[model samples]
Target chain A: MGLNLDYKAELDNIIRDHIDMEGPLLPVLHAVMARFSHIPKDAIPIIARKLNLSSAEVSGVVSFYHDFKKEKVGRHKVQICRSEACQAMGSRELEVHAKKSLKVDFGESTNDDLIFLEPVYCLGNCACSPSVRIDDEIHARVTPSGFDKLISDLRSVNHHKARNS
Target chain B: MRKLFIPNDTSAVAMGSNLVANRFEELIKNKSLDIQIIRNGSRGMFWLEPLVEFESDFKRFGFQSVDLSEVESILEFICDDSFDAALNKHPKFLGETESIEYFKKQQRLSFFRSGLGDPLCIDHYSSLEGFTGLKKALEMQPQQIVDEVKNSGLRGRGGAAFPTGIKWQTVLDTAHSKKYIVCNADEGDSGTFADRLLMESDPYQLIEGMIIAGLAVNANQGYIYLRSEYPFAHATLNTAISRCYAEGILGQNVLGKKICFELEVRLGAGAYICGEETSLLESLEGKRGLVRSKPPLPAIEGLFGCPTVVNNVLTLGAISTILCKGSDYYKNYGTGRSRGTLPVQLSGNIKRGGLIEIPFGISLREIVEDFGGGTFSGNPVKAIQVGGPLGAFVDRDKWDTPMDYEAFSAINSMIGHGGIVVFDDQINMFDQARFAMEFCAIESCGKCTPCRIGSTRGLEVLDKISSKKDVEDNLILLEELCDTMEHSSLCAMGGMTPFPVKSAVELYKEDFT
Candidate 1:
């Protein structure tokens, strides 16, 4: 794939502006990913070259963390809590429901490129039980039905945004 | 003007604080009450979240779990200054949070500022004695600051009790101009909510602690590797950071000095292994939270191969208090080397499943029987896990063990992040042990041979033992494998996963046999 020069420059500025001075290679990587949505496979070489580190070193750090995505991510990400606390609150059932409704398992995105579903540990909302985060917004006490409604709402919102754009 | 504090923490919101907040707004509009509602963080009394605090003179009256349906009565009752029996704030229902034996026994150093101020407001944080530690650290030489922490005997609160001062001094002594301070806020441990609670309740305290650490170690940049689970905490912390920057508490010569420290929050995709410091560092770099071999240790060459100081949320949170109160004040609380109050999280099958801060040396019996009020199901207590999923299980026979670091270690149990999980008599020990191995197998980063393969093998052994397939031989093999993992694993993932399994087998051998 052809690299977008402007996008790469913006990515470079984000790394330089937010994370260049930090010693550990990971925070810079996190900053880059946070800015660009996903860690581009091509950018790994650039990062390795900038930090005077080996490709293995950069790739080691990248592969060790579950958060870094090599491929493109959907605009909205949905993470369901699969930790013990959430499990005790029936997250297992909720997970099945969410998967069925989203038509994707954990770590997989829908064909529409709208929502990406994944499993998370505890979100510290145990009291509410079965918490799910739609992008940055955490929704608690989420039933399978509630998750379906949320997905529908997100789909509609995305559809609306697409029309506007 | 009538001032009200509605804690906007997840626990409070879970208990319907958002509904109560909206109701309060509606009541003000309809009744024209001269009241301003401010959403703050939880006060650690999680059981009583949606806790509405109304200011009267200097004292604040609290109402626990106030829902929208009861807001009218609550507002009316508060306005009249009459104790409403229905609203549960009457003298009969008003349980004094401070006077409650659970709250009374806690020293509350790290959690001192939590729930006492608006985390979003810098003025409130300042009024409540926030940033005083950063100011004190800024005035002294970095070495002197490090010396003070060393003397205070503060250890990492993230399971492993490594001394914070030693780590800082090592990083400081290391010849590196480019050092980084990474705060591990990936509190994925099931029962441990202290890190999350501190982050959501008192964001500025953590920031102050990080800034102080940065100033002490001469590092200009810091990152809080928070879990994706805590969206509210992430949002609140970001707001707190913005407010700090606006108020000159962070970034560019903080407090009119030449010390420049910038902080950012990095979210981890929900992986349990990321709680490990090295794995956390790896994840912060946008990698999977797989463990790395030690020897270089994060202090000498960490982050991007420069010297770095990686600490747990509670360990750093305790710094501000130690700096403010002095080492002597902090040292006077806990027993022996475990000298400080520990913010113990009481969870699982307990009547009072909430956060409690207590001085060290307190017996597990007091916490379990006295404070916890036994199991919520009213059954006899069978086994209690003092740490996280990986922590060992202590049966009723060993309930008298003191909660100090040495005491737990003496009994072959470590106070891993002070997460106390209670299990009633109805719980099956074999099932629990099986679950522990299963949890390890599922969450293991699959980096090393011992953890990746050993955990799966361990689970199979546990299954055989539980299912009575050559139960005795399987039990022996399980112990042997646990020993190998404990000695040879790269990190605590395999090292500590055996804690629950071994302890369960040792404590409840009958279940396995």
Candidate 2:
């Protein structure tokens, strides 16, 4: 009950802050996604109500964009660039290596819910191809070995925190 | 005391600039060094980053690809009595930043101040002639400003080569209580980072350009619709914008004048269609980024149904130079109607790849071989995709074609957003052609049937051709599909999706068979 109330309070603050801005929907949705990692299903109606929009309109926006997540994602979200520039520099091979190592295809989370893999069109790092973004940090010139190191680093850091707690 | 410049640009940071900077700080402190480390923007030299530039006797020289291992030795070189000579003997030394042959052979007007000083420093910006354009624009009338832009021959750098002066003139002529200057910073091209570079490096230049645009169009408000993929640019622009506001460059009083111009940066959801003007406006209005039809062009009715002048980031960036140095100065560069330098992005399977800003008439071969230094894999170059995904793939035969807007259009290709993605001979053109169709299908806004359904169908037909079961029939069907999408689609998303596919089939038919 306490967690639910806290979540609701947070959602209300996000809607209230962005409601007065010009075209407040994307901003409100972006804020919600940033805070929650994914737009909570219940937050949609609340956002629509504050912005004088329909739930359907709000939901349509969430579905239309690839950034707005429908459900909870893993702790570490990995996006591999699948665009032509990255492909030209062996992104296809990188993508294959990533999926195999993660033991999951694009848009799937591992059974441990630690790593989620998705294919992003472009991250604007084309100058250094075969780019990968783990959460917010972008890694460039990423080979199979480089990817393995990145994943291991993430796991080790998280494991260290978990053990400390 | 000498200053050490390290790039905080996204590409530089991604290549571990932060790690090098941290190590350098530790090394400098331990050695009790008098050098200052400034986190500047990238010089568009990706291969040589994290490039560390040291100031010695009023000249800036760089050391390429500096990592943690070289941090201590670099500090020693910085502390050396004969700094320039010691740095020259250092294995990773790159002479002077501007005198490098790759950077020396080009024209850099819009990107004049990039990688020079701290991007966020207002004092540094002013010293480099940052707001001179705005000062000139303030002295001129609205019509005069528009006329100057028109005379400069500046076109929309986003994709369409539409004259910018005419668009501003339309907005200025149209009387409305509310007007807008929308800077299309939604740079979604796969092999392009010019917009990101400008925003991240010389951010105040973009802000100054937007201010000039707002003043010219009599629009008191401006919005930069930036893509979410560019988190670095978003943060840089926001910080630069806040700095502008604090310094009285933005908000109610424009540089203490009675005029008022406000600016804000709006983020785009992960939709490539939002790069389109109308779609960008729709997305800005907090709705699905569906493409709006023409007849009421964006110049007449744009964001929130008001008269708006939507210009690409580079086009707006050029406005400052044109206003400060005069239209004739800008018009002196480039050949034919495309008068000005274009910042061409060299990326994807290329050696020495980075940003190349040059006049329009430079050939593709000059760009790929001379500047880019050929493929990274050392393989024979198979094909090159000029522009973005919607751009055509040019074969070896077309390498000599001059890279102006007119020359490219004559060959069913375009220098769209000035992005050049190279592919080695190892790449399968059949797969590339299929990927273009698939990309369209994935990104189409579903507003038009031709782009939405046609893309999926086109992908399926390509897959069928790949299977070799009904190859001849599928090839004919693909051509028809390409024709339909080219003519019937609402916007470039649908209309130009066939460019890569058609060009691939024409140039590399062996891959298809």
Each candidate's interface RMSD (Å, one decimal) is 3.6, 0.8
User: Where in model 2 is the C-alpha error above 4 Å?
Assistant: A1-3
* lDDT value, residue B145 of candidate 1: 90
- DockQ, candidate no. 1: 0.30
lDDT for position A142 in model 2: 94
lDDT of 1 by residue, B1-513 (tens): 877888887777766688789989988999999998987777777666677887767667677767667788778777775544443645323444466666666777888777776777778877877878888898899999999999999999998999999999999999887899999998888767889889988888899999999988999999998887787888889988988889888889798898899999887765788889888877666555667788789999888788999999999988998898798888888888998888888766666667789888889999878887887668887888888788888866778988989999988888989987777776677877777777778788887888888989998888777677998888889999999989988888888888888988888888888
What is candidate 2's CA lDDT for residue A68? 92
Worst 10 contiguous positions by lDDT, candidate 2 chain A: A1-10
Query: Per-residue lDDT of B1-513 in model 2, one digit per residue for the tens?
Result: 779999999899999999999998888888788889999988898888899998877888889998889988888887888775677788888888879999999889988788888999999999988899999999999999999999999999998999999999999999999999999999998999999999999998989999898889889999999998888999999999999999999999889988888899999988999998899999999999999999698888998999999989999999999998999999999999999999999999999889989999999999999999999999988899999999999867889999999999998899999999999988999999999999999999999999999999999999999999689889999999999999999999999999999999998999999
Alpha-carbon deviation at B41 in model 2, angstroms: 0.7
RMSD of each: 3.9, 1.3
Writing each residue's lDDT as its tens digit, candidate 2 over A1-165 gives 123778999999988898779999999989988898899888888888888889999999999999898898887889999998899999999999999998999988988899989998888888888899987788899999999999999999999999999
Task: Flag regions of model 1 displaced more than 4 Å.
Answer: A1-64, A68-80, A85-117, A126-165, B81-97, B285-290, B378-380, B425-428, B464-468, B509-513
